[model samples]
Target: MDAEHIRAIAQQTGCTHIHPGYGFLSESPQLASLFPEGGAIVFIGPSTGTLRVASDKMQSRALAVHNGVPVAPGAHVSSAEDVHKFVEGLGSAPFPIIIKALDGGGGRGIRLVYAEDHIDHAFRRCVGESASRRVFAEKAFVGPGWRHVEVQIVGDGLGNVSHLWERECSVQRRFQKVVEMAPSTLPRDTVGHVIEAALKMARHLQYKSLGTFEFLIDDHAKHWIFLEINPRIQVEHTVTEELLNIDLVKAQLQLSLPKASLEVVLPAWTMSPQPSPPPGYAIQLRLVAEDPHKDFRLSTGTIGPADVFWPSGRGVRVDTWLSTGPYYRGGLQWAVGVDFDSLLAKIVVHAGTFQEASARALRALRETRIAGDVKTNVEILSGVIAHQDWSSGRIYTQWLEEKVDQLVQLGNTQLTRQSRGSLSDTAAPRRLSGGTESATATALLQPGASFQLSLSPSLPQAASGQQTQKHTLVISSIGRNAFPNELSGTITTSLSAMPLSFSLSQLSSIMASAHTEFANPADPSHVASPIAGKIVELHPALETVAGDANKGSYVRKGEPLVVISVMKMESVVNAPASGRVVRVGRGIEVGNIVAEGALLCVLDVTDMDKGLARL
Candidate 1:
């Protein structure tokens, strides 16, 4: 948590309090303990003791059991042998078991092992992703009917705690929450039991500040089990705030004050034994910068000023730090890379009814327009919101991943309709202030053309008669034609005005150069990295034949060759065919960052049919 650096900064700025603002060191015991009681700076979070137990999955499970809470059968494991033994003990309980990092949260260090053959790989991956290199095996509650629900609790570190209702976080991908809503649809009695259970644990620990107690519910069995407690504020906290009309962040800070109590810091109504139901339902959709079509790979690039248009109006809120302008000029500089989170924004909507909320969310999503080199999960969010299953409340944690293809199709259709409507609305060609001439007049737009446009807009004359403020839009290279009605090339720009118009033919001839020249489908000798990330693991098969073209190691098609970690997500690069490794890419090693399309290996395939079949 960089205690020395933080202390120095606080001393230099004369600050007395530090709010971790969730993630990173928000739940770190070391961070909280760094600033002792009555120290120069106070950490706005739970006590170090609380963080120690809550941050470790094994310890938290023990605490839950000690407090008479139900937890799934699990055991801390450090090796694949331990996982195998644990699975063997399960007997016929279930084939798929979940492996979780002992100190992981925010759905980062988790893997689902579906078969005995995958146990080792899944275990190793979990270890690699974990900060402590510790993992555990547990009985997984697989389902089409199971739901993930959590209770929002606030405490004053004095054994006084209050529940702020529950949230449904069932819509997820890769175990990470994608959509969250306040006021779960579970029966009132069931929700009451969860709230009571959460409060019981909070009171037992005297948990301070705001935290979320997560639980997994099996709808078919009418059963539930304690998952784990998030010792700090959550990413989906906005939905709860919108539903309850309360400021959780403010409450968290106030609770951090000495002598603060729940009764003193919270509303009188919240102190009731049975607080009133929230006024409305609220839903939050996470907008991540990823390409859903490519297995949700993390996308990195600049978003032009005209590339992103956020939605607005009543009952809607968009929270984000993304802006499309130069960093020094007070614009948001996108620094999302292998080291940063892919979350770009969160769109929250509140309405009187669930259906109304869903409709409003869809409207807001449709109104949002994000273009340029950067890809986002807006379509995925739209698909989940518009699905019949989502509208009917028939969703679970795996619902999004299970129906991702169908959802993507639906979202694309909706997007196409919206695009058509927008095109019709702006059928007339607009003129720039420079002249009536079309921006595409001088250029013979074609694939691979090195054409660029720099617009120097004439700003109003200053009192000192300074030169007009100018903005530039650089178009580097055009590759292939795709969108006939829109310019398909990548534009590096700072202009926030309407996009310049181009003829259909001209626009059709434009494409980003980066999208050109993919590996030929007919070639099976080469393998490339599908995304930009750091290589975290390499298969032993490659090592056996490294730098020895004459001595190749045989590998089956679809076998994992390497694993890449990007933005905290791991993706496996598999053998492209049933082949022998001639050689791996020079300088390819674990911990090395690789760009998309970078060569990873060269395979001499012996069976083409096997590769195609695997695909």
Candidate 2:
């Protein structure tokens, strides 16, 4: 949204074109208008008018309604009273009402209000999250099998538009898409209606460049509601491109030409009488750097090039910003820090059938190996693809959340099975593949670091009342790297003469535990921040809990205490147990950055039942 800075840079560098590739200023009408028509520079995106209308959720909903498209029951709301009235108007339609920002996307600035008391908090959070300070209330379409579908469309400034097809994005976490597949599993006729609806809106507005028309389908697949239009390319655009064998970014550039048209930009589609479904199936998985075991908390650390491995083949494609060059300070090492998106890369696979695609995706995930202190969603992605429900297409937006525990267990079991026989019987350290010896040495034993290695007999030992032998290894020095895979190091170890053996996985586990143990707070009374992020809002009841004389506020277990915003997602920190807040951490307030493991508050558990408090 910093149009002036971008303009100044473009002018200084003598650049003639600016392509806002999704996010940030991609949907900013003000940014698009900065480079006027016939100017020295051109904005490779929709015109200012189209951006203004499409970026506003309320205006887009009104446009959908005017064009005879169905939209959920909703109204512009500025206060809790307006939200209550909107809910009253719905009557018995639905219990949970959704509060959303008027101009938010990518699942941010949204809250689900399930009761009247939560309306005010959700409303205030939405207002604070939105840049416009505007919000809306709508009846939520709670479903056991609801699906999120979107149509890919491209148009020129002259009102000519082409529908590229639709994508099924039902697999999501916290309203953010996790997996997307091209050519929805819905019936042909149902998809046809959605495509036509998208084209109608795009043609009416003469929408130029690429955009997405999002919709929510009911469980029965018999009804759908217009959600909103994303007036820019999305993260899932790779799914559509892989399915159709076309370059969407190239197409966007071609359409921005002075005299571009559908016939010139896409001759293959113009020659056909109607838009035909592309052959084959393509699935894209969003590989994020997060820990599913910790409620998808963002994982931050330096991931060396030798610490990770990527899958590649004929039909598999991995798109990421990771590289191994001196241009970056870390040189191919992923320095995943806080205050940024958790997305690491997108792994896309294409096959002749859905089953084949799923199988290939599983194989690719199994081949992926990420080590060191960083964590990823690769295991969770594998679990989802291998689930029976996923294979049978019985999924919805909330399905992952409901089955996360089961899926995590399944993924762990699969991993265990894969590594069952990986250890060798020989009493020697095995060399790990895809990693330099120096890098491996650096990972296992840094200079002056001490580690313990337990040694067990390679063969059955005689029954004895003695403890197993242990070795204390200390790293003395790590000489300069003279070769890529050569390392000179001295490991002073106290070892006994015995047939002993250990595996590489054991060493890796020790290294990981040593690095991450500090992030887990030891004191139970201290409420620690789960991840590094900014505290956006503090609980109202916490005001009186800051003093010693007040006795603080009595909060029950699972009650919210603070809301933290990180990586464009909001996470609520709830009370761990029934207790009174006796102290708030110094400098912990709204808009304050809180580090992981930093104390947020202190809880007084005098009134909490012992049994209840343990929970």
Candidate 3:
């Protein structure tokens, strides 16, 4: 919400009460305090002191340990001496120790201590980060495996508290939860113990309002430790809402209002009441602008030609901040600006089975086209869906690490197919007569060599440092795409054969001759557009750079003809190796499209003083 609009709304609505969702203004006691003073709104949350206490990672860990809640072993250090003091005691704990910034969470201020020698470097880095982000450190949670379990609780104004069932949020990437579902995969007794600890913590602080206590469950399922508590609504709150018919937001408002009466509608919380896994399964894939496979850095800019078709049959919900119209109705127009671009557009899908839902969502995501500088990690998410581990429900917090290469390949493949308009047609392997293959090979290469050959700008060399420069380029079996394992030995070249097996290096290095025919050739000024789109820039050099044809006002063929951009692909057309500038036109941008050989700019291939020969 914008500033002016929010203020106007506050004025009109009388600002009786405000409940900022989690990660927003939810835990801001200072902002909450402003409500009562302004005599307009009331902030619904705990006291300012409690907010400070919960926000501090070290302080919270100490509290949890003091209250008999198990926590990972580690001491909060402030400087180098503090680290020296604690390092001696960390006997046999393993190599990868975690050093997290006290004030930071959500995987931002965290580093892995890979080796003993790296501890000092890791410690110093964390200290600097802590000072900057106002955080401290504790022993990182290193175990066989980690499971994120969260419990949502509501407190009555009179100090009565109740715990809703816990949700297992173990599926993650970059420490951010991607998929969360109700009824944790942990044991029933473990869930009870965590809930008991959570209630104790809440009572100790007298926290009144909606809150969630987080815990890290180790691999053995024998040990569960309290991590900390999120003082506001989380992004995954929908998971709990889906499992339980209760609206947590409404409950929070009622509980915060002192005069509002309370009702015991939900029965005393029981573990078995989690609704038997909801019949089918549901998964929410966060459509983040930033690439998870690419360091998770913030990727900003507009998403053009944005159009979304929601699945409305049933069991599907789309929570997004996207719209369309003349502003973005055209095929490749920008929808959002650079700012507010990094946020996600979440797609919640549900089906009778996990596989079905995942497949449906994948299809929907790929079919829709969202162009512009703002790139989404839709390809990565699809890869996860297709992965055997993910599809089989064996996903873990670090699953993405093992599948990084696969994700990158999938992303690049999608981008290439989309750009080239090759996504539509899936061709079958063509079968050529043995004689035909032999004849084509003999025709296109030197004596005894098989196939036509042209090297691209980049010639790929093998690990042996040997660059193959022959008609039938040789490649390792692995580099050849879709070739049968049996034929990987030595498949002779065949130019006429379709779906030919070639290495990526081979394809990229295949360049047509400079004099390759363009069907209807023209002079420098007669030469057409560079890109496959409408004109965008026509340099003034058409006359000066290409001299004059008749009265020196004419262009001396063979120069930068013109610039055009189609489907976002841009290039400047120069004389077909050499030509003269004849005609120049207006500029073009994002929305225009051009045919194979449409006359965009004209060039004259004539001999002049400033022509190719002159150079």
TM-score against native, each model: 0.82, 0.82, 0.59
**Descending-lDDT candidate ranking:** 1, 2, 3
Q: Count the backbone clashes (under 3 Å) in each candidate.
A: 1, 0, 36
In candidate 1, how many Å is residue 244 off?
1.5
Q: Which 10-residue span in candidate 1 carries the lowest summed lDDT?
A: 503-512
Best by TM-score: 1
Give the per-residue lDDT of model 1 (tens digit) for 1-615. Answer: 686788789889999999987886887888888888789899999999999999988999998899889999999898999999999999785577999998777677799888899999888888877888899999998778789999999999889889899999999988889999999877778778888899999999998999999999887777999999899999999999998888999899899888998887878887888876777899999999889988888776544343456788899999987653354353333445667788888999999999999989998998876554467898899999889998887899898888999999998877666644543223223333433222211333443432123333344333234323322122454554432223444445544453342211111111223232223223568787777777888877677666565666767877899999876667888876677677777556787776555567878776445545544
1 or 2, greater by lDDT: 1
Q: What is the full ranking by TM-score, best candidate first? A: 1, 2, 3
Quantify all predictions' global Cα lDDT against the true fold. Answer: 0.77, 0.76, 0.53
Clashing pairs in 2: none
Preferred candidate (TM-score higher): 2 or 3:
2
Extract clashing residue pairs from model 1. 448-478
lDDT of 3 at 527: 48
Q: After best superposition, candidate 1 residue 60: deviation in angstroms?
A: 0.8
